[model samples]
Target chain A: MSILVSNLSKLYGDAKAVNNISFEVHSGEILGFLGPNGAGKTTTMRIITCYLSPNAGSVKVEGRDIQTESFEVRKLVGYLPEQNPLYLDMNVLEYLEYAAQLQGVTKLMIPRRMKEMVDVCGLGEMKHKDIGQLSKGYRQRVGLAAAMIHDPRVLILDEPTSGLDPNQIVEIRSLIRNLGKQKTVVLSTHILPEVQATCNRVIIISRGKIVADGPIEDLQRNLHGGEKIILEVEVPGGQSFEMVSVQVRSIPAIETISLVEERDGVKKLSVETSNATDIRKDLFQLCVQKGWGLLELHREKTSLEEIFRQLTAH
Target chain B: MKFANIKYIFQKELRSFFNSPVAYIVIVVFLVILGWFFTSNLFIANISSMRTVFEMTPFLLLFFAPAVTMRLISEEKKSGTLELLITKPVREYEIITGKFLAAWALYFLTLMPTLVYYISISVIGKLDLGPVIGGYLGLMFVGAVFLAVSVFGSSITENQVVAFIVSFLIVFGLFMLDKVLFYLPSTLASTLEYISVDYHFSNIARGVIDSRDMIYYASSVGFSLFLGTVVLQKRRWS
Candidate 1:
C-alpha cells in the first residue's frame, strides 16, 4: 500500500468534517474521491497532506505516520489545495524553483527538476510570464507543476479539474492519467465523468462518511439499479413502428424500454437492464435481422447526483 | 528548522514584496520622512549627532513594522496558500522564521540610506563613532522585535487591516510605556521600564550595549515568533 488512512476524525466546533473514515491507496493507482459540496473531500485531503491533524486517528503515507513522522510524510506527499493557490507575482519557473527548494530538493537537482516539471506540465511557454497574467487554466497548470517539483511518491490533488473549460479539463485529465502511471494519485472532484475518465476506483463521501467505495462499475450498478443506453433505430422500409417496438420488448435482459423520440421513421429508445450484459451485440443482431439501421447506440453514464441525493436526502 | 526551506520562503517573500509597487512606495515614504527629520535636526537645531536618526526610527517603526508584516501571513491565510506551504516538507518554525527574517531584512535595508547622516557628520565636524554604531545596532534589534510582533499579529487574523491594527496597538503600548514611567511608583516603574522597548533602546543608543538590553531584545523577538507559530499550529488542530 502507498497511503493508509485509519479512523481519521476531524471536528470543526461541534460538527465533524471527517468522521472515522478509513481507506488505503495502492501504489500506481488512481483513486477518485467523489463527494458533493461540503462532503469533507477537501478535509480528507488536508489530513492526508499533514495540513491538519485528525482528532481521533492517524494517516500514514508510505510508512511514515502523519502525526509523528510528518516531516518524512510531507517529503513523500505533494499537495495542490482546493484553491490551487500560487504566488501570482512569480513566473512559472520561479515558483517551481521555490517549491523545489522548500521540499529540500538538492541544489544540484533544482534546475533539472524545474525544467522537467515545466515540460511535464506543458508550461514551457509560460515559464517567464507572471502567473497573474496567465489565465485560470495556466495558473492551475503552474499549481500542478509546483506540487510535482519534488517528485514525491504520492500526489494529493483537491478538485484539480474544477474551474476549467472542457478543453482544459481534457488536457488536465490526460496529464493526471499520465502521472498515475508512476505515482499514487488521489484526485477529488464532484464531476462523475471525471472519475470515470481518470480514476481506477472511487470513494464516495457524504456527511463525512464513506457512502460508497469500490470500482466505478460496482458503485453505479449497486446504487443505480441498472445500466442504461440510448438506442436509435431506423424503421424497415415497409414495417410500422409498432412492430419494431414489440420486437425490442421481447429481449428478456432489458427490463425497461421507453421511446424518447420518434421522427422521419427513426426512433430513439432508452434501454435499462438490471445487470452488466453485452446487449449491444444482441441489439445489433436484432437490427441486422430486421433490416434497421443503428443510427446511434451510446451508453448513458449514471449520474452521481442521483446517488448522492438518494443517500443524503434524509 | 531547515535553512534551505527557510531560504526558499524568504526569497519568495522578498520577491513578492518587490514585485508590487507597495514596497517601493513604503521605502520611498520612509526615506522621505526620515530624511526630513535628519535634515531638520542638522540645519534647524544645529546639532551634529546621529541622535535624531536613532530617536525617530523607533517611533517610525510603530507604523512601518506593521505595514511590512501586515500582509505576510494574513494574505496567505485569506488566499488559502498557507496550506500549500505547510503541507510541503517545511516546518512551522521554518515558515515563521523565514517571514520574520524577511520583514526584518526589509526594515534593515530601509534604514540603510540613513547612513548619509553619519557620512555627512564625519565630513563637516567631529563624529563620535561609538554611539552611531551602537544606535544602528539598537535600531536593528528594535526593528526585529517590532517586525516579529507584527508577524505574530498577521498570523492571528485573516484580514490585513486587522493584523495592522493589532500590531499597531501592541507596539504602540511598548513604545508609550516608557513616557509614563515618572507617573508610577518606583517598583512598577522599573518593571514597565524593563518591558518597554524604548527604555532598553535608550540604553544602547547611549553607546552602551549591555547584555541585559541584548537579552531583552532576543527574548522579545523569540517570544513573539513563538506566539506566531502557536497561532499557525492552532489552525491545524482547530
Candidate 2:
C-alpha cells in the first residue's frame, strides 16, 4: 500500500471529526474521495500528509508511520490543502522556489524543477506576477505547482477544483488526470461526474465513516440495489396500455413496471429487477411468445449520484 | 535544523519586510522619535553623549519592536500559509528562529542610523566609548527579548492587532515589574527586580558587561522561543 490509514480518529472537544476510519491507497491509481461538506475528507487528508495528528490511530505512508517518521512521510507526499493557502505578497516563481527549498529539493535542481512545474501547471504568464494579482483560477494553478515542485510520489488534494469556473475546472481536471498516470493521486470533491471522469477507484465517506469503497464500476454495481430496463413494444391497435403493463409485471423477478409513454402504435415500459439478474433475455423470449414486436430494450444501472445520495442521506 | 532551509525562510522574511511600506514607515517613526529625544536633550543638558538616546530607546522599543514583529506569524496564520509552512520537512524551531532573526536584524538596521549620533558627538568632544558600546549591546538584547515576545504572541493568534496588543502588554508588564516591586516585601522585591528586563538592561546600559545580565537576556529569549514552538505544536494537535 502506498498509504495505510488504520482506525484513525480525531476529536474536536466533544465532537468526533473523524471517527474510526480505516482505508488503504495503492500506487499508480486515482482514488476519488466522495463526501459531503464536513464529512472528515479534509481531516483524513491532513492526517495522511502529516499536517494534523490523529487522536487515536496510525497513518503510514509507504510503510513509514506518519507520527514517528513524519519527515520521511512528508518527503514522499505532496498535499494541496482545501483552501490552497499561499503568500499573496510573493510572486509565483518566488513562492514556488520557497516551497521547493523548504521541501529539501537541492539548490542546483530548483530552477529546472520549477520550470517543469510551471510548464506542467500552465502558469506561463503568471509565474512572474505577484500572487495577489492573479485570478482565483490562476492562484490555484500556482498552488498546484507549489505542491508538485519537489515531485513527491503521492499527491493528496483536498477539493483541488472547488471554486474554479467551468472551463478552469475542466482544465484542472485533465491536469489531475495526467498527473495521476505517474503518481498516486487522492482527491476529494463533491462533484460526482468528475469522479466518474477521472478516478478508477472511489471511496464515499459520510459523517466520519467510510460508507463505500471499491472500483467505481463495482461500487455502482454492488452498493446500488437494482437496474432498470427500458422496453418498447409494438402494440396492436386494439390493445390497451394496462394489458402490456400487466404482462411485463408478471415475470418472476420483475419488481415494478411503469408505463413510460405511447407513440407510433408502440408502448414503452420501464422494468425494475434485483441486481445480478439479467432479465433482458427472459423479456425477449416473453415478447416473442406474446406475438409483440420488441423495438428497443436498453439497460440502465443506478447512477453514482443516486448511490451517493442514498448512502449519505440521513 | 537545516541552514539552507533557515536561510530560505530568513531571506523570504527579510524580502517580505522590505517589500511592504510599513517597515519603512516604522523605521522612520523610530528614527524620528530617537532623533527628537537626542536633539531635545542635547540643547537642554549640553552633553555631547548619546546617553539620553540609549536611556530612552528601550521604552520606545516596547512599541516599535512589536509593530515590526506583529505580522510575522499572524499574517501567515491569517492567510493560511502557516499550514503550508509546517507541512514542509523542516523542523518547527527553524521557522521560529528564522523569523526571530529576521525581525531582530531589521531592528538592528533601525539602530544603525543612530550610530551617526556617536560619530557626531566624537567629532565635537571626547566621547565615553565604553557606555556607548554597552548601551547599544543592551539595546540589542532588549530588542531580542521584545521580538521573541512578539513572535510568541503572533503564534497564539491569527489577528495582527491581537498579536500587537498581547506583545505590547507582556513587554510593558516586564518593563514595569521593577516599579511594581517597590510595593512588595523587600526580599521579594529584589527577586522581581532580578526577573525584570529593565533592571538588567539598566545594569548593562551603565558601561557594565556582567555575565549575569547577559544570561538574563539569553534565557528570556530562549524561554520565549521555546513557548512559541510549543504554541505551534499545540495548534497542530488541536
Candidate 3:
C-alpha cells in the first residue's frame, strides 16, 4: 500500500471528527473520497497527510508512521487543502517556489518542476500575477500547481475541481487522470460525476464512517438487488390495458409493473424484476404470444447517484 | 529542524510585508514619530546626542511591535493557509522563529532611517558613539522580545485587531512593569523591576552592555517564541 490508514479516530471535544475509520490506497491508484458536507472526508485526509494526529489508531504513508515520522511522510505527500489556501499577496511563481522549497525539493529541480506545474495546471498566463488578482478558477489552478510543484509521490486533493468552469474541470480531471498513472492519489469531493470521471476506486464516507468502499462498478452492482426493464409496446385492439396488465402480472419473476406512459396507441411500461436474472427473453416471448408489438426493451442499472443517496439518506 | 525551511518562511513573510502597504506604512510612521521626537529639541537646546530617540523608542514599540506582527499568523489562520503551511515538512518552531525574525528585521529596517539623526549629530558635534550603538542594540533587543510576544498573541487568535490588542496589552504590561514599582511591596517590587523589559534595556542603553541584561533579553525572546510554538501546536487540538 502506498498509504495505510488503520482504525484512525479523531475526537473534537465530545464529538468525533473521524470515528475509527480504516482504509488504504495502493500504489498508482486514484481513489475518490466521496462524502457529503462535514462527512469527515477532509478530517481523514488531514490525518493521512500528517496535518492532524489521530486520537486513536495510526496511519502509515509509504512505510513511515505519520505520528512518529510525520516530517518524512509530509515530504512524500502533496496536499491541496479543502479551501485551496494560498498566499494571496504573493504572485503565482513566488508562492509555488515557497511551496516547492518547503516540500524539500532540491534547488536544481525547483525551476524545472515549477515550469512543469505551470504547464500541467495551465498557469502560464498567470505565473507572475498576484494570486489575489486571479479569478476563482485561476486561483484554484495555482493551488493545484503549488500542491504538485514538488512532484511528490502521493497527491491528496480535496475538491480539486471546485470553482472551476466546465472546460477547466475537464482539463483538471484529465490532468489528475494522467498523474494517477504513476502516483497514488486520494481525491475528496462531493461532486459525483468528477469521481466517476477521474477515480478508479471510491470510498464513500458518511457520519464519520466508511459506508461504501469499492470500485464504482462494484458499488453500483452490489447495492442493487433487483433490475429494471423499460418496455415500450403496442397493444392489440381487443386487449384492454387492464387485461394486458393482469396477464403480465401473472409472471413469477416480475415483481412490479407500472405504466410509465400511454401515447399514440402504444404503452410504455417499467417492469421490475425480483432478482438479477434475464427476463427480457421471457418478456419478448410473452409480447409475441400476446400479439403486442415490442418497440423497445432494455435494462436500466442503478446509477451511482441513486446508490449515494441510498447509503447516505438515513 | 531544517534551516532552509526557516529561510524560506522568513523570505516569504518579509517579501509579503514589502509587497503590501503595511510595512512601508509602519516604517514611515515609526520614522515620522521618532523624527518628531528627535528634532523637537535638537535646534532649541542644541543637544547632539541621540538620547531623546533612544529614551522614547521602548514605549513607542508597544504599538509598533504588535502592528508588525498582528498579521504574521492571524492572516494565515483567517485565510486557511496555515494548514497548507504547517502540513509541509517544516516544524512548528521554525515557522514561529521565521516570523519572529521577519518582524524583528522589519523593526530594524524601520529604525534604519533614524541613522540620519546619529550622523547629523556626530557631524555637528563630538557625539558619543558608545551609547548610540548601545541604545540601538537595546531598542532592537526590546523589539525582538515584543515581536515574539505578539507572535504568540497572533497564534492564539485569527483576528488581526484582537491580536494587536492582546499583544499590545502584553507588551504594555511589560513596558509598565518598572513604572508601577511603587504599587507593590519591597520584595515583589524588586522582582518585577528585575523582570521588566525596560530595566534591562536601560542598562544596555546607558552603555553598560552587561551579560545579565543580554541574558535577560535572550531568555525573554526565547521564552516568548517557545510559547508561540506551543500555541501553534495546541491549535490542532482545538
Candidate 4:
C-alpha cells in the first residue's frame, strides 16, 4: 500500500473530527475523496500528510509509520492543502526554489526542477511574478507547483479546483488526471463530475464515517442499485397521467416511475429498475402491445452526484 | 539534523523580513534610539565612551526585539503557511531554530551599525576595550533571550500585535523582576534576583563574564526554545 490508515481517530473536545477511519490507497491509483462540508475529508487528508497527528491509531506511508517516522512519510507525500496557501511576498520561482530546497533537492537540481514545474503547472510567464499579484487560478497553479516540486510518490490534494472558473477547473482536472498516471493521487472535492471524470476509485465520507468506498462501477451498482430509463409515449388518444403511472408500475424489475411531464397527448416517464439489467425491451414491448406510440426511449445512468447525495444525506 | 532544510527556512524568513518595510523600519528605529541615547549622554557627561550604550541596550532590547520577532511565526500562522512548512521533511525544531537564527541575525545586523559609535569613541579619545566587548556580548545574550520569548509568543497566537504585546510583557516581566525582588521576603527575593535576566546582564555589562551569568542566559534560551518547540508540537496535539 502507498498509504494505509488503520483505526485513525482525531477528536476536538467532545466532537470526533475523524472517527476510527480506516482505508488504504495503493500506488498509481487516483482516489477521489468525496464528502460534504465538515465531513472530515480535510482532517483525514491532513492526517495522511502528517500535518496533524491522529489522537488514536496509526497511518503509514510506504510502510513507514506516520508518527514515529514522519520525516520519511513527509518525504513520500506532497500535499496541496484546502485553501492552497503560498508565500505571497515571494515570487513564484523563488517560493518553488525554497520548497525544492526543503524537499532535499540538491542545489544543482533546483533550477531544472523549477523549470519542469513551471512548464507543467503552466506558470510560464508568471514564474517571476510575486504570488500576491497573481489571480486566484494562477495562485492555485503556484500552489500545485510547490506541492509537485519535490516529485514525491503520492499526492494528496484537498479541493484543488475549488474557487476556479469553469475553464480553470477543467484545466486543473485534466492536469490531475495526467499526473495520476505516475503518482498515487488522493483528491477531495464535492464536485461529483470532477471525480467521475478523473478518479477511478472513490471514498465517500459522512459525519466522520466512511459511507462508501469502491471503484466507480461497483459503487454505482451496489449503492444505487441500477439505472434510470426515460420513455416518451403518445397515446392514439389523449391518455391521462394516471394510466401511464399505473401501467409502468406493473412491470417487473421496475422499482419506481416518476412522471416527468404530460402535454399535447405526449407523456414523459422516468422509469427506474432494480439492477444493472436493462428493462427497456420489456417497456418497449408493453408499450407496443398497448398500442402506445413510443416517441423516445433512452437510459440515463444514475449520476455520481445522485449517489453522493443519497449516501451523505442525513 | 538536516542543515539544508534549516538553511532554506532561515533564508526564506530572512528574505521575507527584508521584502517588507518591517526590517528597515525596525533597524532604523533601533539605531536612531540607540544613537540618540549614546550622543546625548556623551555630551552631557563629557565622556568619550560607549560604556553607557552597552548598559542601555538590554533594557532597549526589551521593546525592540519583540518588534523584529513578533511577525516571525505569527505571520506564517495567520497566512496558513505554517501548515505547509511543518508538513515538509523538516523537523519542528529545525523550523523554530531557523526562524530564531534569522531573527537573531537581523538583530545582530541592526546592532552592527552601532560599531560606528565604538569607532568614533576610539578615534576621539582613549576607549576602554573590556566593557565595550562585554557590552556587545551582553547585547547578544539579551537578543537571544528576547528572540526566544518572542518566538514563543508568536507560536501561541496568529495576531502579530498580540504577539508583540505578549512577548513584551514576558521580557518586561523578566527584566523588572530584579527590581521587584526587594518587595518580597528576603529569602524569596534573593532567589528571584538570581532568576532575573537584568541581574545577569548587568554583571556582564560591568565587563565581567561570569560562568553563572552565561549559564543563566543559556538556560533562558534553552527553556524558552523548549517551550517554543512544545508550542509547535502542541498544535498537532490540539
Candidate 5:
C-alpha cells in the first residue's frame, strides 16, 4: 500500500472531526475522497499529510509512520490545500523554484526540474505573472505545480478544483487523471462528475466516517437496484395503447410501465426491471408475435450522481 | 532537514518582504516616527546618550513587532498554505526559525538606519560609547522577545488583525506591570518589578550586562517560542 490509515480520529474540543476512519491506497491508484461539507475529508487529509497529528490512530506512507517520522513521511507526499495557499507577491516561476529548493532538489537540477513542472502543469504563459494577478484557475494551477515540484510518491489534494470555470475544471481533471497514471493521487471534492471522469475507486465520506468504498461501477449497480428499459411502439388509434401498456407490464422482471407520450399515434413506454435481467429479448419476441411496430428500445444506465447522493445523504 | 533547504526558505521569505509595498510602508513609518521621537526628546533635550530612544523601544515594539509578524503564520493559515509547507519535508523548527529570522532581519534593518543618530551624537557631543553600545544591545534583546510573542500570537489565529491585537495586548500588559508595581507593597513590588521585561531592559540600557538580565530576556523568548510550537501542534488535533 502506498498509504495506510488505521482507525484515525481527531477531536475538536467535544466534537470529533475524524471519527475512527480507516482506508488504504495502492501505488498508481487514484482514490476519490468524496464528501459533503464538514464531512472530515479535509481533516483526514491533513492527518495523513502529517500537518495534524491524530488523536488516536496511525498513518503510514511507504512503510514509514507519520507520527514517529514526520519529516520522512512528508518527503514522500505532496499536498495541495483547499484554499490555494500561496504568497501572492511572488511570481509563478519564482514560487515554484523556491518550492523546488525546499524540496531539496539539487542546485544543478533546479532549472531542469522547474522547467519540467512548468510544462507538465501548463504554466508557461503565466510563469512571470505575480500570483495575485492571475485568475482563480491560474492560481490553482500554480498550487498544483508547487505540489508536484517535489515529485513525491503520493499526492494529496483537498478540493483541488473548488472554484474554477467549466473549462478550467476540465483542464484540471485531465491533469489529475494524467498524474494518477504514475502516482498515487488522493483528492477530496464535492463535485461528483469529476470523480466519475477521473477516479477509478471512490470512497464516500459522510459526517466524519466512510459510508461506502468501491469501484464506480459497483457503487452505481448497488444503488440503482436494476436496469431501466425504454420502449417506443407505434399504435394506430387509442385502441392499442392500453394493450401495449398491459403487455409490457405483464413481463416477470418488468416492475412498472409508464407511457411517456403519444406522438402521431405512436406510444412510448418506459420499463423498469427487477435486477440485472435484460428483458429486451422477451420484448422483441412479443413484438414479433403480436405484429406490434417497435420503433426504438434501449436501456438507461444509472448515473454516478444518483449513486453519490444515495451514499452521502444523511 | 538540510541546511541548504532551510537557507532556501529563509532567503525566499526575506526577499518577499521587499517584493511588496507592505515592508516598505512598515519601515518608512517606523523610522519616521522613531526618528522624530529621538530627535524631539533626546537631541533637543541636549542629552549626550540614546537613553530616550532606548527607553521608548519596548513600547514601540508593542506595536511594531506585531505588524511584522501578524501575517507570518496567520496569512499562511488563511490561505491554506501552512499545510503545504508542513508536508514539504521541512521540520517545524526550520519553518518557525526561518520566519523568525526573516522578521528579525527586517527589525534589524529598521534599527540599522537609526545608527546615524549614534554617528551624529559622536560628531557633535562628548559621548560615552559604553552606554551607547549597551542601549543598542538592550533594544535588540527586547525586540527579540517581542518578536517571539508576536509570532506565537500569529500561530494561534488565522486573522492577521486579531493576531496583531492579541500580541499588542500581551506586550503592553508586560510593560504596564512595571509602572503598576510602584503602588504595591515593598516586597511584592520589588518582586513584580524584577519579572517586568522593561525593568531588565532599563538595567541593560544603562550599560549593565547583568547575568540575571540576560537570562530573563533569553527565557522569555524561549518560553514564548515553545508555546508557539505547542499552539501549532494543538491546532492539528483540534
Candidate 6:
C-alpha cells in the first residue's frame, strides 16, 4: 500500500501555494514533511487528508483515486491538523469517541478502541478532563489519540509536537516511533530533531515544491558528507603559524581552514574535509613534527539544521 | 451521510452549544426582551391579540437569528476545526446540516417561552387561534430562512461579527423590499412584492396557509443553504 501524488498543484489567486510537486510514501514508513512557514506543508497535508482538493493533480491512496473515492481514502487516513483542531469543551474520551463514531467505527468496537488509544497515547489521566483544561502537551496527545481511534492505515500529523516541552516532545516522538511500526505515517514539522528522532525518510519542501526526498541517513550522507575538525594550536613563537598553515594546506583532503580565534599565542583553527575523512590524525602528526604544541583537537559532524537550511533556503 | 456520524456530530454540536455561556445568554436575552414586549405593550395596553408581538417579531428576528448562526461556521473556520471536521469520512453537507440543525433547535427552544403570550391572549380575551397559530408558523418559517442566510454568511467569512452584520443587512433588505417596491410602477411593484419574503410571510401570518408562501420560504432556505455548501466547496479550491 502506498500514497502517490503526481504533479499536484494548488493555486490561490495568482500565487501557486503548492507547485507541481509529487512524492510517494510506502506502507510502514515514517515520512517526514519538512518545510518553513507557508511552504505548502500544511496545504499538501490538507490535500492528502481530503481537506482541500488540488487544482491539478492526482492523489492516490492505496491505489484508489482520492478525487473519485474520497470517502474510502478518508476511511484509510487519519489526519491531525496543525492546530490540533479539537473541541475544547469535550473531554478526551468524549472527543475520541466522537471521532471514532464519525469515522464509522462500529458501536461494539468503540469501547475497545477507545481504551487502546487512551492507553497508547497516555490519556488515561486526562480522559475525564475537558480538553481546554489540559496542558498543550496533553492536548496534543488527545489530538493524536483522536486520529488513531479509528485504526486507519495511514496517519497524517501536522506539527504534532509544536509548543510542547522537551520531555513531552521526546515522549510524543517515541509514541510516533511505535506507531510507525504498523501504520504509514506522514509527519510534518519545522522542528528538525523530531524528524531525525522519529521519521525514517524525509521530504524537504520549500517555496511550494519538493527540494529533497530520501532516507534521512542518505540525505545527511549525500548533502553533507564530511567530518569537520577544529584545531587549537599553542605555538612557541610566531614562526609556528607559517609552518602549520603550509603543512595543513599541503594535505589535498582538507577543504578549508579558518582561524577561529587567536589569544595568548594560541591559535584555534577550524579545518574541514571532503566526506567523512578523518583529518584529525593528519593534523596531529603534522603539528607534532613541527614541534607545535597541540592544545586541543576535535571532529564535528554536519548538523541537521545546516542541511535543513541548505535544502529550504530558496 | 452515515446516520451514526450525523448523530454524533449533532450531539457534539449540541453539547458544545450548551456547555458555553453564549447559548444561554442568547436564549435568556431573547426570552426576556420578548416577554417584556408582550407584557408591557400587549397586555398592559389591553390589546386582546398577539398582533403586537407578531408585529415586533420580524424586527427582533432581524438581529437575533443572525446572532444565533453567526458563529456556526465562522468560529469553526477561525479555530481551524473545519479542517478536522472535514477530514472525517462524513460529507461536507453533513457537517453543514449538523451545525444548522443544532442552531435551529436552539432557536426553536428560544421561541418556546413566547408561547406564554399565546396562552395569556387566550385567557384574557376571546382569542382567534387560527391567525395566532398561523402567525407563529410564519415567524418560524421566516426565522428558518434568515438562519439559513446567516449560516451562509458565516461560512463565507472567519469573523463572526462580519457574518452577523452581513446577514442582518440581507434579512433587513429582504424585509424592506416589499415596501420599497411601492415607489415603482404598479406592474413592476406587483412582481417585486411577490418575490419579497415579507409579502409571503404576511400571507401566512393572516391565517392563509398558501402553498405558494410555504414553498417560497422553503425554497429560500434551501437556496441559501445550497449557496453555503457551494461557498465552502469553493473555499477548498481557493
| A231: Cα error in model 5, Å | 2.0
Model 1: fraction of native contacts: 0.92
lDDT value for model 5:
0.86
| Chain B of candidate 5 vs. true chain B, TM | 0.93
How well is each residue in A93-195 modelled by candidate 2, as lDDT tens digits?
A: 9999999999999989999999999999999888899999999999999999999999999999989998999999999999999999999999999999989
Cα distance off (Å), candidate 4, residue B135: 1.3
lDDT (C-alpha) at residue A271 in model 1 = 89
DockQ of 6: 0.71
lDDT: the better of candidates 5 and 6: 6
Q: Give DockQ: model 4.
A: 0.80
| Local accuracy of candidate 3 as per-residue lDDT tens digits, A1-314 | 89998998999888998999889899999999999999999999988887777899999999999989988998999899987988888999999999999888899999999999998888998998999999988998898888888888999999998888998899889989999998999999999998999999999999999999999999888999889999989997856667777888776788988989888769888999889888898889989988889999999979888999999997
Interface RMS deviation of candidate 5: 1.4
User: In candidate 4, which residue pairs clash?
Assistant: none
Q: Judging by TM-score against the true structure, name the best candidate.
A: 3
Candidate 1 per-residue lDDT, tens place, B62-166, comes to: 999999899999999998889888998787888999999888888888989889888988999899999898999999999988999999999999999999999
Off by over 4 Å in 6: A225-271, A274-299, B1-4, B43-47
Q: After superposition, how far is residue B143 of candidate 3 from its true place, in Å?
A: 0.9
For candidate 1, the per-residue lDDT at A245 reads: 69
Off by over 4 Å in 4: A234-258, A262-266, A274-277, A285-295
Q: Each model's C-alpha lDDT?
A: 0.89, 0.90, 0.90, 0.89, 0.86, 0.86
Model 1, residue A210: C-alpha shift (Å): 0.9
In the range A1-314, model 1's lDDT, one tens digit per residue, is: 99999998999989999999999999999999988889999999999998888899888899889989988999999899997998877877888888888888899999999999989888989899999899999999999988999998999999999999999999999999999999999999989889989999999898899988888777666786567988998886746656776898777789888889888889998889878675887888888887889999988867666765676665
> Which portions of model 3 miss their true places by more than 4 Å?
A236-240
Q: For every model shown, what is its TM-score relative to the native structure?
A: 0.93, 0.95, 0.97, 0.94, 0.92, 0.89
What would the per-residue lDDT of candidate 4 be over residues B110-207, giving only the tens digit for each residue? 88999999898888888889888888899899889988888888888899999999999999999899988868999999889988888887888889
